[model samples]
Target chain A: MVSRPVGFEQQASSGALGSVDLGPADLVPFDDRGLAYGDGLFETVLLRAGAPVLWEHHRARLALGCDRLGIPFPCQDALDATWQGDPTAELEVLKLILTRGSGGRGYAEPESITPRLLSRRTPFQPVVKRWQEGVRVRLCNLRLGHQPYLAGIKHLNRLENVLARREWRDASIAEGLLADSAGRVVEATSMNVFWQQAGALFTPPLDQCGVAGTLRAALIDQGAVTQAALPLGELSAVDQLWVANSVQGVWPVTTLFSTNGSRLQRWPLPASDPLQCLAHPLLGFA
Target chain B: MVSRPVGFEQQASSGALGSVDLGPADLVPFDDRGLAYGDGLFETVLLRAGAPVLWEHHRARLALGCDRLGIPFPCQDALDATWQGDPTAELEVLKLILTRGSGGRGYAEPESITPRLLSRRTPFQPVVKRWQEGVRVRLCNLRLGHQPYLAGIKHLNRLENVLARREWRDASIAEGLLADSAGRVVEATSMNVFWQQAGALFTPPLDQCGVAGTLRAALIDQGAVTQAALPLGELSAVDQLWVANSVQGVWPVTTLFSTNGSRLQRWPLPASDPLQCLAHPLLGFA
Candidate 1:
């Protein structure tokens, strides 16, 4: 019941990636499992000069998420064409949402389903201010619930992140830190957190909770960091803290505080950037 | 950007609630928070002769959910109209999915959003067989992680339930049991579970995790049950087991076993029905 669009869209129709090989701007089916139960997976890739940055990592993560969620991935041709499609902007963000098509009431998956692919592009802006001067971070009262099956997957069930992000609204505070109920650090809202102590890099283990971000995974794969179960109480002892994501290479944390503004910690700019080589080289952040 | 549909939809338009008094079937905006972050709540009500059954419980629960998620409720006029709207079906299931409209990005709210509501009706089929003879249930290997802030609310982030339901596909298994990592039973994949022992009715305490089901609430409100900490291991000792929700009222358990089918427990259809008065009388199972 769908009529194909004409050609490559002049601009991503609102959130649509244009009517190119990626398909037209289609309305999300009312019974989409993604919208229904968050039964879907998504990946946000940074685009520069009409080309995607870190395309491999983003695609791999997306595929992993699709596998775990049991949602079928789009064909390779579609994935390739969608990734290469020019977003008609020098800097933009492309989001791919893969849902398990549609289903009726129960949680049981249909024997088969034609997976739905929704791609959209939005303008991307680098955070030179937060990256250079550093940003303040705070502890969220909302704790990350530990679910191993979903740990580290960038699936769409992100209410925890939304709740944590809702904890604070100071646009000035670039990021917020989240911990599991046991007081062990998990990660930051929307970004994975990293710390350097005694010249060794460490990130919170996401096996229990937290999104294993694309940048975080790449950095570790490149031997720039390691994962550990860092406790929130010991965060004050850390030498430096930073948050990383594909869209924004790295945002260094300059100050840390509690919800009541009582417990506090701070870190000064380092002698040199520790993530210079580890971050997505294409991001080209100074 | 949709033309309204007139009259009742014989078949559910995938997710469309059919164009009755709920207004036209509009396409979900691309930036909807529900699809982006599962930032929403939903309620499924059983309808009899085009009239909603247990409307107050579902509406109250939806309001509680919206309050917790900080989403504005649809005005009383809109809610009343939709709730009272005729779906033109004698026996049907109405689903209400309320999302925080659309937002730009990040977890922060958009300051203002007109909550979007999607309603759909599906044919209802009561499980008279299960209600009369207990159905088999198995323990899921996936353990729910504890998150008090999110507990007891039927938020849209239901990947845990989706994953638990994936544990088995046998049409014979009516439901799967889920528990927190501490071995405490939480609830079934969809329904809230209850047990009777020593002439006392107890349900798994939802303070740590699990959705507070509607009928479960009505039953508790009418003094039919109490909350208690239940461990999966202790379930074998219970004299009788039951699962409940507004849709089916109650499905007793004849046999309970582990995911591997190793551990087992069974209770026959007793002399008298313990849930005779508690169940929704309209189901009228013989």
Candidate 2:
């Protein structure tokens, strides 16, 4: 486990990098935009071998999200300084939160936006082995409120995730799956869902809800899966069911239970599903 | 303006109250519930005399919120002990935040919920005079998402409020008003709305959205105003407009403008309306 202090660090002169300690006083000032408006985007990257598993994708998506939220583009040099080129630090899980720095208390953002980037590292843990054994899943009763404008992107306004996560207390059930207001499955508490359908891989399209998982994004890029905007009825027809997120990597679902008393047994992926030969450098499992 | 340390006192087992030098470390032990799930409720009470304004009402609401959230109800005697008889601690503000004391990752709240309650005092400041002069108002473009299950109670999932507050940077405007997904006016960014119409007072019903402010609750109870579900377009017919919240009390709106270029004048509560005399004692305004 990473035994580092869990406080704010000093910002470098560029207002981007360097170590600054943060406390409650910093909460309201670190851009009330972040706290007051959730006007920010964040990425959680699993670092292995001194580099983020999908660093490029994480950075690119963060940039895209920043653009969407109107936050200024992040500087590479400042971001590089955050790592300090410590190759041994690859064992850490980094959570990078970029906020549109404090501006007027109102919503109209300032013309020149200064982004607040907080990069912190925690001890990394791997959950890939769990996929082979599979994990239990429960359906969350709290349906995600939909907003097409904010779907797919990882913006900070996550009260819905917070509420969904609070629905159950059973630790054995690794995750909760959420549906949109219309009862179409969206995602797990913090992961994206995918299923093997008709001998091909299918995952829900996030255009209407759910965060677009980086691992899922990578899988799609590799042609290992196709995006399907399927409703709940189609879920029963799918074969192997799995969930993936940055931190968790991927985990197979062995059991699923719905509030309406529907039960689905485990659907294992076929040998042709490409789980074995996926060539992302971070997919180190042989 | 109140000038004092932001952190509050934590009474020792000796029953002596001493200022707790709580920084980030102290807040950490309080758990992940408050930050992670927003599974809590908070109260910000203005202090006019040595005591918190409307302590009973605030306490009652906190209790109600705790009951609904499944948090343990705190001992009232211990809560009162936090304030003691320090009625002369100088005019200050009291902030109380209660959380389902932290445990369990990902939403299955712990069975034995230990509610964490914090009471801290800061100096008090009232901009009540600003209400008479009337404050500039703007309508937020970001709409409050609907969740009937979570409405009315002051739960921590406040990303909607944060997003709405970030919609503008114009300091000239005092607050931004928000509407629900159905496009009905609900409340101001941090306050509740009440307007004068045809010699009567009308405030939007909180049954579906927005917080039920203590001041608004009191006015409705005292036969001082009528509470009804009103729509955004209905405001155009109002005789005058004002916003009420726990901290800012009642603020008269002199002008209203929608981002799309619609504008309306709302000030000078008609002389015939009893709202002029409806400001409660807890409001500390004439």
Among the numbered candidates, top DockQ falls to 1
**TM-scores across all candidates?**
0.92, 0.80
Judged by lDDT, which candidate is best?
A: 1
RMSD (Å) per prediction:
4.3, 5.9
Worst 10 residues of 1 chain A by lDDT: A1-10
Clashing residue pairs in candidate 1, if any?
B17-B119, B17-B120
Report the C-alpha displacement of residue A7, candidate 2, in angstroms.
17
Judge candidate 2 at residue A132 and give its lDDT: 57
Provide the DockQ value for model 2.
0.23
lDDT at residue A35 of model 2 (Cα atoms): 40
Tell me the lDDT of model 2 at B135. Answer: 81
lDDT of 1 by residue, B1-286 (tens): 1322222111233333334334335456567888888899888888887677878888889888888888776665455444454455567887778888777466777875667777677778787787777789999999998888788888889999998998888878889999899999889999999999999888988988899988888878888899888877799999888888888878888899888977488888766778745665734434
